[model samples]
Target chain A: MPGINTSSLPDIIFMLLFFFMVSTTMREVTVRVKQRMPEATEVQKLEKKSLVSFIYIGEPKNTKLFGTKSRIQLNDVFASVDDIPEFIAKEREARDEADRKFITTSLKVDGNTKMGIVTDVKQELRKSGAFKINYSTRKKVERRSR
Target chain B: MARRAAPEINAGSTADIAFLLLIFFLVTTTMDVDTGITRKLPPPVENPDEDVDVKERNVLKILVNSHDMLMVDGKRSDVRLLKDKTKDFMALHPDNPDYPEITTKFIEELGKEFPASKGVISLKNDRGTSYEMYIKVQNELARAFNEMKDERSVELFGVKYSQLVDENKIKAINKLVPVRISEAEPEDIGGK
Candidate 1:
């Protein structure tokens, strides 16, 4: 029996590689907090990723250093509520003048976290003039009733 | 002289190179789409003490205690019943003084006057309330508003609200059934 040709294997591999590269996005910030986002039925896909800045809220992975309290994360570092305005300003400055108005702050708060910290973050965001915000949540699938 | 055929380039290592790059991308990237409940925060008030004089009947107050118990319009209610309750509250019940008063306004996009509910959902939660419960309450309120919009869209355009792609039609629907959920500052209710 003649050996089967395997010349198309490289092309197939390259196709898969290209698909992954196009569909996936690079993880921008290293998440120091343990974030388990809450589930919700009413969710809209965040459009224009460039215009979205993320704020992570959850207990730190290293409990020894950061304590048990929920900490706010802006970019790669753990930040307090006071740092949010500066973070917003920095984010705004990074973008073009036209795109500055379109910036949205996405809050990825852990489900188990208390509302007090979240509210504080929200108040800080309000003072900073970041009116548009999104609560990052996983899509909850509902079971059909008979 | 007969032209010699060019040698075929070796392609066996291409698969290895592709595999290496694919692994790199797989390690560095994430496939999950960022989805969430979008909201607009009201601008910071100049005078925090000054209260807006909204009529008593127009506001539907929803409170979530630290224990995750729900209180809707001063009545203890289940989370499952919230959507239906909100829908009923916002419905055009002109004769019912308990329900929100309706104001008919001329919508430019629709080119017809429609009754818009003056109802506003006020959500207040305790400082110790879990984020999960807050999101659940928010989801229910959003669902109620979405259903109202869908109902109106079907009656006017013969299609579901999500199915309507026209910008003006969407704007008209939004104007007809506005999502007026006002979240209040977290209080230290029900103790820490």
Candidate 2:
């Protein structure tokens, strides 16, 4: 039997490797809370990922340690409602002075969570002067007419 | 001694190296694009106790309880009917005194006078209400305004509001059918 050349196999694999490398975005934080977002029909795509700060609200993954109550997460740590202003301030300071106005605070709250926690977070955000807010939600694909 | 070509190094392991890196990236790749409902928060009021008077007839009250029950204008209603109800309430109905009052203003972009509805949707939910119900209500309210805008856009520009690309045309359409949903602070109306 004649041997078929396998030299091009490396080139093809290298091409795929480069494609994956270019497309991949590393997960920024260790999500310590369960985050099943709510679904909505009128969702807008969040532009400029770098300019968006995320606030997660859900039951903690380690329920035994953190208790069953929902908690707020800023970056990788469990945070309280009071920590929100400081977090927003830190996020603004990290960016360029001109880009501060464009920063959007994205709230990723679990659907099962109560509105009280989310409202508290919103009020804190408002007080911090971060008026631009995005309620992170999944897109509802099937549209049902009434 | 005759010059000799260097022996070719074996490239057999190159594929394995590439495969390793590709696997790493594939595992790390999160293809999920972040999407959400964008909203602008009303600036924090210095005097929160102060009240702004809006005509009682001009505001549509929607209340959601902890059990996810909806109340529109003090009448229990289904979520499915919210869009149409809002549309009817906001549509220009000069003969109907129960509906919002219409004010005529000349739009610079359209170069004509248009009667704009002064209707505002006031949504209040209990603190114990689920986030899912809140989003559903928000979605319905947005749909109501969007459908009205689409209708007006079709009438004037022969296109859907979302399909219109011209900035001036969009401005005119927005002026004709503005979205005015005001969410109030959640109260402990429904005991958890």
Candidate 3:
């Protein structure tokens, strides 16, 4: 005669589920922008980030404003220096809930863009009260012209 | 034996579900990677380093005023002109031909011309200027410096871009070229 002994199975399952939920991390939202990253052969990788923010460099179409270049998106777009701290703060709050440390940001500046704009973003981030910032860069891909 | 054995509540199915959920989350979790130019910032000063005489010549001072005015080396200049002048300042062997990265060129040129001058870029921005422009300046400066370093290795040292490019070497050189970005106080820039 077979018997069903059922007490440890539930406990084991609950433990496993709880472990996964705590260990799991959500994917960060990234914005599309071209960046000329500094050439560093040996770059140290950073693991923890409180917030990840992206700044896109380029002019908005038909906008006289300094930072606004395109007419499409606002959330993805950061028009001026004043907008940085707010974005960083919001990201900080999100990260804080998860017990994260510092806010991290990536500024993607176009090759044709002016250097002043890059400096502006850096300065803003520094003042935005978030000390840590990451500028994104792509590995140089060798393209063979067909 | 017939009166024993309370009803068995099998919780095995729930346990299996929990285990599966845990595995799923572990597989789906994403990681964050941080990247950028690393520079050792000067420690904060209580009284501030007032005696530090920051030279205007060797140190490229990029000033963006409230009205979007760009100033290089204390003189107000257009962005295009600034780029050209910066290139000229960095270009060491004008007659040798083949322009290199502007920042690297500038450093090499400075090293040759002003041997005692420490090659550094000090960025100062007016309080009222928009933030977007500030980042642009920093990026351009870093780009310019990086370009100069790359060009110097190629043109001066005969190291082509295709050569065994050691990234550590580039980073080493970049580390020496420190950047000090300073912002004018509210009273200094007439900002509220």
- lDDT per prediction? 0.92, 0.91, 0.52
Candidate 2 per-residue C-alpha lDDT over B1-192 given as tens digits, one digit per residue, 9 for 90 to 100: 998999999999999999999999999999888999888898887887898899999999999988999999999999999999999999899968899988997899978998888899999988888998999998888888889999999999999999999999999988888778888865667577
DockQ of each: 0.80, 0.81, 0.18
Off by over 4 Å in 3: A1-25, A28-132, A135-146, B1-41, B90-119, B160-168, B175-187
* CAPRI rating of model 3: incorrect
| TM-score sort, best first | 1, 2, 3
- CA error at residue B170 for candidate 2, angstroms: 2.9
Can you tell me which runs of candidate 2 are displaced by over 4 Å?
Answer: A143-146, B190-192
Task: Grade the docking of candidate 2.
Answer: high
What would the DockQ be for model 2? 0.81
For A1-146, candidate 3 gives per-residue lDDT tens digits of 87877767778677767776776666543443433443333233444543555566644533544344421111555456667668767766766565544445655554445445555555666566556555444332334553
Candidate 1 DockQ category?
medium
Spell out the clash pairs found in candidate 1. Answer: none
